[model samples]
Target: MSDTTPRIETERLVLRVPRIEDFERYAELLADEEACRFIGGHMPRPAAWRRFLQMPGAWAVQGFAMFSVIEKSSGLWLGQLGPWQPDGWPGTEVGWALHRDAWGKGYAYEGAAAAIDWAFAHLGWTEVIHCIDADNAASQALARRLGSRVLRQSGMPAPYEHVVVDVWGQSREDWQVRRSTRA
Candidate 1:
């Protein structure tokens, strides 16, 4: 009854479930000051695993979940990206994160686009939202690249205010056309 698929490949990255082998690498990235600059502060290794394990259930309930992103050639664990369904959201949301080394590259766009495509194409999702910190310019740009428009600026958790952006997606008919055009 789970729609949680295995690996989904984009142009330069492979989006897949987090394996135990990924813990050390993921922990290293999460612990990096630069990588954690915009998001939550450094996470402990066990906490990271707990967070990763929660994705499958989120996916089962909402039909989409975060995927660990790996570079196809190097097979390095970059970070995570995908659709999330949180409270007060009308639909699923797309989000991304990467290690500092992966910054300035197009991994965010590549992985995010693929997940949006999959959601609209296969999951019957009509829209995707992105909630980003106001100061996180990089993430805002990524949201725009995925064709999302800012919905509002809202508080996240208790302390941070994030800009809420939403992307209206392709209908099945639209997806078919896009697929045909790409082919």
Candidate 2:
């Protein structure tokens, strides 16, 4: 993790901004057909390279973006999750995509919880959404686990205009209530 980048540590994961060292694994994750299925489909190296750059660009330009989720024990790149608000987005979002190897380990939920807190506390976001594909029941379950319900159905922009997604979210007030209850 870069000292300059913002980071959040959970019990078993480290969420931090995308660094140059992360590209290989990021590209690998993007290339896995099963893993990338719901996340705009698996791409070749060239396309993966372009897609991989988006996170760092978002961090550098927008001052916030998905963090590279690292396993605390293995120090491995497990996934990405955090604040994301691109042009034509459905809403302020805390999105996630994990390497298949990391699935079922609860990393996405763990990282996203921290990301949501960071977005609400540091970014001053009023609400946060997850643009989940209809067929992705795993993500749907994760969204529910995060205390977000389906706020609406929405279409994407430009290259993804043909794809529609469920906007799952909760307000800052709702999240605070959930957090307090969990405590």
Error of 1 at 55 (Å): 1.9
- Tell me each candidate's RMSD, in Å, in order: 3.8, 1.2
What is residue 102's positional error in candidate 2, in angstroms?
A: 0.1
Candidate 1 stretches with Cα past 4 Å from truth are 1-4, 60-63, 87-91, 157-183
Q: How many residue pairs clash in each candidate?
A: 0, 0
Off by over 4 Å in 2: none
lDDT of 2 by residue, 1-183 (tens): 347779899999999888778888888898899999998999898998888889988888889999999999989999899999999999999999999899998899999999999999999999999999999999999999999999999999989999999999999999999999999
Q: How well does candidate 2 score on lDDT at residue 18? A: 82
TM-score of each: 0.77, 0.97
lDDT of all predictions: 0.71, 0.93
